[model samples]
Target: MYLHSVAAYLPAAIIDNAHFTRLNGLADEWIIERTGIRERRKAAPGENSNTMAIAATDAVLAQAPAFAADSIDLIVVGTYTPHDTIFTAAHAVQRHLGINEIPTVSISSACSSLLNAVEIVEGYFAMNKARRALVVVSEHNTAYNNEEDTIAGHLWGDGAAALLISKDRMSPADLLIREVVTGGAAPVSKADEAVTLKPVERGIVMPFGRDVFQQACTYMARVTQTLLDKHHIPNQELTYLIPHQANLRISLNVAKQLGLAPERAVSNIERLGNTGCAGAAIALAEVWDTIKAGNKVIVTVFGGGYSYGAMLLERN
Candidate 1:
């Protein structure tokens, strides 16, 4: 699969560290030192995951005006925080785009949802089941998170991203999807209980921050290096690293493990907080235009469910 276009949507409402100070009594410096998140975006009144997904899709369409909505044969949305449980965000996006008779699906693997969605599109392309695909990742974390929770509540944010992918390269500037690999570590000790979000009970909670940090730091680097080794690409040859926007410390740790410079690792968590699965995609959209031809980029992700994945892309 080739990426033809990409776009992201961040809500206008900005939730700064001071808001958490007032709500949870956590100081600004404390939050920043621990999570590197000074501020985050929150969906405004009446804005939800579906609406944000549509906004991102519209942005993608706007970026690639030649890519018609009717050409999209597959629509996949990766979101854990959906507005409605029955009516998914994928269908909502398909409806908003006015494209019908296409296969639309939604899947969630916590923060790793974006890469999983891309892998799904890869499968369709491999089987010749789809020609053009639309992948949207949206998160409405604040809707299900408890602002009062002092543990992980402050880390939640709302955002969305859309990617226009084709079975073959559409243009000279299209990003070639070299490979995508995903795996689960739920079998690891205490993996299932490390982080959780229960809508009826409590919101997003991280009972074992140390465990999550250790596993995230380990697996993100492992999966990234796996892809590099598989392609026989050396660590120094990597042009950029886009890690999951869960924590700045985790991203730095992964970069160090891979012997890559910290500056080469793209990060938006400092300003956007952890926008769930949309974080990496949002970062990709922000830096898409600056990437040069022959550049090799890797996007590695580790999510709360202990799911991990990575994707290798090259500009050709």
Candidate 2:
């Protein structure tokens, strides 16, 4: 599969650290030192996951003027936070785009949902089931998080990203999807309860922060290394490392474990906080234009479900 174009949508409402300080009594320095997030975007009154996904998709389509919307045969949305569970963000996006008679699916694997969506596209391409696919990852984290909660509320943010992918390269600047690997770590101790969101009950909460952090640092780096080793690519050869925007510490730890410079890792958490599954895709969209031909990039993620994955891409 080849990545044709990508774009991201961040809500205009900015929630600074001071808001958390006033709500949860968490100081700005304390939040920054732990999560590296000074501010994050929150969806406005009318905005939701589907709307954000549509915005991102519109931006991506606008970027690729040559690519017709009618050519898209698959639409996949990755999101854990949905405005309407029954209607689903995927169907909403498909309806908004006016693309008909195609397979539309929604997937949720916590924050790792983005890569899982990409893997689904890979499967469709391999089976000759689809050619051009539109994958959108949108997260309305603030919709299901309590700002008053001191545990993990301050980390929540709202954002969305869209990627236009094709079974074959559509342009000279297209990025080839070299490999994608994803798996779950539910068998690990405390994996299932480390983080959770029960919209009907308590919203999003992190009961076992230390366990989540330890597993995220371990699995994210391990998965990235797995991909690199499989392709016989050295760590120094990697042009950029785009890890899930969960925390700055986790990203830096993963980069260090891989023997890569911290600067090599692309991060947006400092400004965007954690946008759930949309984090990696947003980072990819942010850095897409600057990536040169022959550059090797890795997008790795570890989510609350104890799911972990990595995708290797090369600009060609």
Candidate 3:
């Protein structure tokens, strides 16, 4: 079990809760009380999900340059916010990678996009479906984040992560992909408003922060514990708990309930906030250096499907 490579990308624009408050009629205290979010990033003009994911993919592939794009047998992209209406994020990524012949698919678990990608790619390897693949994820949550809701506005960022998986020298210990689960109706917005064109002018806003919290907390904990018990891995032993950037408080509380120490649980929520499907991936990317060749990591995510999913992976 070995991880061939891991990489990520962050947009240049930064948005703090205070700055968002000026646009949305929400208060910082209210946002902080509910979600432990300080700030999030926004993708600039022409900087959509594809461009972001490409950056991370380049970095990860650079780490393992021996492999070529055409050599990748499968491509799994995680995202709810895609760049085009008709195109899957994975297809766009393949186009950008200049490798369109390979199979590609997109997973939209809101914040769990990356985990789902990992799960799918892992299954491909475990079931002997395909051995070499790229798991790519990028979420520009601010694309629809209503600057109006302090809860949602301050809790998102733009970032991406990519991991090249192979059966080669990535190390057997790093190749473990243990569990996967998902439950939800749809992760998209349920608002009555019609989908509009100009995303930059009016953001994609989620008005149901409280409901999201309740659903995410319960689902993340249940799936996380189930995976841990099934794999015989203890939360106490995991080197890092990479959670989808939802809110600071929610992440903290979930860690406490799972018996993981605050330090052991890694989060970029304070600085990066939530990048939706890319949340966990970006967080993991930032901490890529700290993880050794064989660190066991627990990646959990509860996203907008009202949907949630969780998985376990060993670091390469």
Task: Please list the C-alpha lDDT of all candidates, in the order they appear.
Answer: 0.94, 0.94, 0.72
lDDT for residue 132 in candidate 3, whole number 0-100: 85
Q: Give the TM-score of candidate 1.
A: 0.99
Taking every candidate in turn, the Cα RMSD to the unseen true structure, in Å, is: 0.8, 0.7, 3.7
lDDT for each residue of candidate 1 in 1-316, tens digit (9 for 90 to 100): 7999999999999999999999879999999989999999999999999999999999999989778888999999999999988889999998998887888999999999999999999988888989999999999999988788898989989999999999988889999999999999999866888999888887788889989999999999999999999999999999999999999999999999999999999999998999999999999998999989989999999998799999999998
**Who is ahead in TM-score, 2 or 3?**
2
Question: Candidate 3 — which pairs collide?
Answer: 1-171, 1-172, 1-175, 2-175, 36-248, 144-204, 144-205, 145-204, 146-205, 157-274
Where model 2 places Cα greater than 4 Å from the true spot, the runs are none
Check candidate 1 and list the clashing pairs. Answer: none
Worst 10 residues of 3 by lDDT: 188-197
Model 1 residue 295 distance off true place after TM-score fit, in angstroms: 0.3
TM-score of each: 0.99, 0.99, 0.85
Q: In model 2, which residue pairs have backbone atoms overlapping below 3 Å?
A: none
lDDT of 2 at 62: 96
